[model samples]
Target: MRSKVGLVDLVTRYIIRQKGKKIRPLLVLLSSKLAGGINERSYRGAVLVELLHTATLIHDDVVDNADKRRGLWSINKVFKNKVAVLMGDYLLSRGLMIAVDGKDFDFLGVITNAVKRMSEGELLQIQKTRKLDIDEETYFKVISDKTASLIETCCTIGAMASTQNPELIEALRKYGHSLGMSFQIRDDILDYEGTSSITGKPVGGDIREKKITLPLIYSLNKVSKKEIDSIKKLIKSKNDSVAVKEIISFVKKQNGIEYAYNISRKFAEDAKNALTVFTDSQTKLALESLVDFVTERKN
Candidate 1:
């Protein structure tokens, strides 16, 4: 118990200062209370979601070779990639211990399954990186796994822990799924539409990494075959600043950003609709507000 407490402290000391919205943990708690009630077990599940989310950010910084996160030096920038990865693993282990020790077996299943899906999603994206022909259908599946799975897990576990009703659980899960998709699309759009000064990241970072996000994917679908070949060749050059700039401009002309934003709004609306079965409550209102927050977030 002492070791566990010490480990938790170490993890918290590293992450507690990080600036994030903590939306996932909020979802866990909100959904739980909306479904029926909140208890010690529900708070445990929310904490586990937060730990898992922080672990993912650590690992993602290592993989993306990102130096800055939330406008500050990331763990990888300060301690090197090895330390960052180990810290991520430590956080995951701590979350697991918390769940199992609390005897929240069902929550354990929710999170472990989400971790599995998240790993597979990352692998899938890595596998397709630099592949110019990645289609729209495949893009959705990857984002769904990488982003939506955990969001869904947060809501589902919250519902299950608070309510035994299968229907309510299912409704909240759908709400989460739609919200998660909207959230990812918004992030992808920010990579293109937002400034580094605002978003706290470099412009064209996704393009530099050869990530086929929504705007690029839409531009590819709308552009000519000749343009496609030109863009593909430039991306393969491995140092195609000129090409990256051109792609961003072309995406704007093609209304790719607008299209992606529309899609995000649609999902946000769908998320709100998913909660129609629930009677009005503060928790339900908070969930609806979360949908508005997703579309409005700048970073």
Candidate 2:
């Protein structure tokens, strides 16, 4: 990610300093290893996934006007929105160029379609957040597009790079889809139940953003229209502490978290079940353990 320009180099350095978890690339590597062995194509796929993930995070920080990322000053906070946007664009173009130069046109097509889905998902969320009217089905649609598409694509790309077994590739793709769904659902649950010290985010941040996650969506359906209207008013009250606390308590009283947890567990089980195509191996076990880690992670 080096740049000839001094300012660009400075921004890139700052971004690299805050090392992310690199979970997406790790999944790519693991998937590749499961199929066969890590090769040049596998490395290319891993790099492509990381580059795309990083670009999205940079852009997300700008869109959210978030001051911090991973406990460090966000790119937009330090360098302003223009520079941050350019940096994200730079990463995106670089990732695409790598794919093109490597003649990974199939991978290019999949990733471009994922990017489109991600954009559509984000725009849809923005629209829903404005109205606070997202339903359970729409919630699934948003997470699938916004979060799951890239993850499933990572598995697809990994298998494509390292193996020709179509059945194995399809199995990994299903595993990734289920894993992604469970991962996002757990994230939504954490918003209602997790703490700042563990999750690196304040509780009720989603509520403050007026983002209707599954817990809230499910709870809203169970409550009377009167109670729902009251909670909606509180949410619209500009992040009032009373509003946040009450809505959280209301969701709990309605068993929202428990319901969401059961759903996440179902997806996690499906994720593990999708691995039946692979014979017993350490790589396969690692991938199965990854499913547990994502679903049960405190964050």
Candidate 3:
């Protein structure tokens, strides 16, 4: 099969070579291995998942107007918004092409569904912005739709690429869903508690953007109505440098970070348990260790 060298080369050479965790791709590989043996199809599928993830990051940076990622300038920062947008689109299109090359219509359908979910998730966040009364139900709904869905997709594709067992596919999907939720919760906690140097962005970027992440939601639940009003006002204000500090302090005082960590740990445990159906293997152990890494990662 002839590769689309130009588009693939542009994305791999320019966009995807930067420091990325490649977590989704890793999931694909690991899940595939745990269920069955690795194969050429699994490797290609892993690459496709990573490409799709990169495409989303490019688009996310443009939409969020974010400057830094992975401790470096975001593509939107270095390439300008228009180029960044097109680069993202190109990468997404390339991912589709790669999926087709896998010759699995079912896998293609799974990936297309993830793309749809991610689009809807972003739209949901945009629709809810600055409406700071974000409840727990809505918060989980948003994260599951936006973040967990794709991670679940990664595991689903991985299983199909290897063993093609319906039960194992469902099990790994559950594993990834729980892991993804924990991952996002950890991200929300880090936003409140981590240094910019560690997190690869400002400590309060979510607060500055007025994005109601998990910790903020927990803190909002704990605080009085008056405190919620204060937080809403602070988020709406332009000069919020000091307010960011105050919000962080308030969240910690309310045990917002701790609450989020507890929830994250629960999900991590659930993810580890999802592997019980699979027999003992190095890949399974790696998957279990990934849970601890998710909860313990500083960045």
Number of the top TM-score candidate? 2
Q: What lDDT does each candidate get?
A: 0.88, 0.91, 0.85
Tens digits of per-residue lDDT, candidate 2, 157-226, equal 8888888899988988998889999999999999999998999999999999999999999999998899
**Per-residue lDDT of candidate 1, residues 202-253 (tens digit):** 7888888888898888888887899888877766666577877887888899
lDDT of 2 at 213: 95
Pick out the ten consecutive residues of candidate 1 with the lowest summed lDDT: 1-10
What TM-score do all the candidates reach, one by one? Answer: 0.94, 0.98, 0.94
Which model is ahead, 1 or 3, in terms of lDDT? Answer: 1
Position 58, candidate 1: lDDT:
94
Candidate 3 residues 74-192, lDDT tens each?
A: 88787788878877777778778877876767788889988898899888887788466667888888888889989999998889898868899999999999999999889889989
As a whole number from 0 to 100, the lDDT of residue 256 in candidate 1 is 94
> Sorted by lDDT, highest first, which candidate order results?
2, 1, 3
* Candidate 2: clashing pairs of residues: none
Output the TM-score of candidate 1.
0.94
Candidate closer to the true structure by lDDT (higher is better), 2 or 3 = 2
Poorest 10 consecutive residues by lDDT, candidate 3: 1-10
Clashes in predicted model 3? 0
Pairs in clash, predicted candidate 3: none
